[model samples]
Target: MGAAYEGLSEKTRTRRFLASVLHLTETMLDHLVDDVDGVDHVALALVGVGDDRVGVPTAIAR
Candidate 1:
């Protein structure tokens, strides 16, 4: 998840998170990942294979 967020372009991050920064502090990330009730809002990542394996966040939805 952190890797995916770091991989995002600044413009993409800003658009998705409504912030000017490309990265969030660990504390902020933890807060975002916390679940409420039985539900959790999340960003789904698609990971590649082998030595090139990397995560890319594809969607964020409730």
Candidate 2:
């Protein structure tokens, strides 16, 4: 017989995961704004978490 799945609380886990995703998204947005105006002091620079961090920098050519 398969393990009991009835004890798993899907709703709670889903809410927690969504909250975490929202927080990370907000952090990215804050970093974006800081990089744009370049008029404020930012504690954490925008850097990738893993092996994908190294890449070419982009500039808004206008």
Candidate 3:
């Protein structure tokens, strides 16, 4: 993935990968929050966005 994204400018590549991962991650979390009983997502904290992946805190809730 890093090799594939190397052709893109640094800023665009970072944004594109982060957006893709975040979309997939948010979709999974949405499903979990919706299917499980008494479950709620409080916040999403993104610590960093790397070339191949993103660093984000997992779902937190009461």
> Which regions in candidate 1 have their CA more than 4 angstroms from the true location?
38-59
- lDDT per residue for candidate 2 within 1-62, as digits (tens), equals 01222243666435644542322344554554445553454343443355776754343221
Off by over 4 Å in 2: 1-24, 35-62
Superposition error at 42 for model 2 (Å): 11
What TM-score would each prediction reach against the true structure?
A: 0.50, 0.19, 0.22
Tens digits of per-residue lDDT for model 1, 1-62: 88898898888888877878766788877777865344445454454455656555555554
> Where does candidate 3 clash, by residue pair?
none
Q: Rate the local accuracy (lDDT) of all candidates.
A: 0.69, 0.41, 0.49
Please report, as a residue range, the 10-residue window in candidate 2 with the lowest summed lDDT: 1-10
lDDT rank order: 1, 3, 2
Q: Indicate which candidate wins on TM-score.
A: 1
lDDT per residue (tens digit) for residues 1-57 in model 3: 334445666677567555533223545546644544444434334465578797656
Candidate that scores best on lDDT: 1
Candidate 3 regions off by >4 Å? 1-4, 19-62
TM-score for candidate 3, residues paired by index: 0.22
**What's the best-to-worst order under TM-score?**
1, 3, 2
